[model samples]
Target: AQTVTQSQPEMSVQEAETVTLSCTYDTSESDYYLFWYKQPPSRQMILVIRQEAYKQQNATENRFSVNFQKAAKSFSLKISDSQLGDAAMYFCAYRSPGGTASKLTFGTGTRLQVTL
Candidate 1:
């Protein structure tokens, strides 16, 4: 079974600072997809970033980026210039390609506390 892991249960960052959240996974499949989803206190899951297993280069989206080490089965999220709005529960998830409905296997979740 494929599984995502977020070691940090809680983290804090000051406004305007940068924070990196660590993630790791275990999978037997050759091809799969990884994603970082942010869930605010309201509980809506939003896609933060994604990385394909076949891609060697890391993926970045504006203030968000990923350090994906396929060999090590690690995928960490880096949030730059953090803001109060960035405070949320971040979840690391995985999905196998060509699977049913692209169901995501998510981690326990990391609660990010952004302070002013």
Candidate 2:
């Protein structure tokens, strides 16, 4: 079984600062996909960034980046230049991307508050 974990249930950051949301997943599959999703008040799941298990390089998207430690089964999201708009519930998700319809495994999520 695969599972995602987010130890921090809540986080806060000042404007223009940086914040890192920790995530870890346990999976036996060698090839999979890791993702960070943001859901604001609108409740729309937005893809913040993604990492391919086989890729050695970490994934980054604009102000968002991830530190993927394959051996440790750790994947953390770093948000730079944080803005008020970044305040939302961030979830760490995993997908097998195989033939079977492996539904996404998501963490409990972490609520981020951007303070002025």
Candidate 3:
């Protein structure tokens, strides 16, 4: 079985600051996908970024980036230049891409608070 864990239940950052959310996983499978998703108050699940297991380079999207430690099975999200709009429930997710439905397994979630 595979499981994702977000140790931080909540985090806060000032506007234009930076924050890193920690995530760890346990998976025996060598091939899988890791993702960082954001859910605003509206509760729409949006993909912040994704990393493929076979990729050695971390993934980056705009202000979002990931530090993927494959040996440690850890995937962390770093949000630079955080803004009020970044406040949301961030979830670390996993999926076996070739599996049925590409079903996503989510972490407990880390709520990010952006302050002025």
TM values, all candidates: 0.96, 0.97, 0.97
In Å, residue 99's CA in model 3 sits off its true spot by 3.8
Give stretches of model 2 more than 4 Å off.
none
- lDDT, residue 7, model 1: 96
Q: Give me the displacement of residue 61 in model 3, in angstroms.
A: 0.2
Instruction: State the lDDT at 113 in candidate 2.
Output: 100
Residue-level lDDT tens digits of model 3 in 15-91: 99999999999988888999999999999999999999999999999999999999999999999999999999999
Model 2 Cα lDDT, one tens digit per residue, 1-116: 89899999999999999999999999888999999999999999999999999999999899999999999999999999999999999999999977884689999999999999
Locate the minimum summed-lDDT window of 10 residues in model 3: 96-105
Tell me how far the alpha carbon of residue 44 in candidate 3 is from the true structure, in angstroms, after superposition: 0.5
lDDT score at residue 107, model 3, on the 0-100 scale: 100
Q: State each model's CA lDDT, in order.
A: 0.94, 0.95, 0.95
Which wins on TM-score, candidate 1 or candidate 3? 3
Stretch of 10 with least lDDT, candidate 2: 96-105
Better of 1 and 2 by TM-score: 2
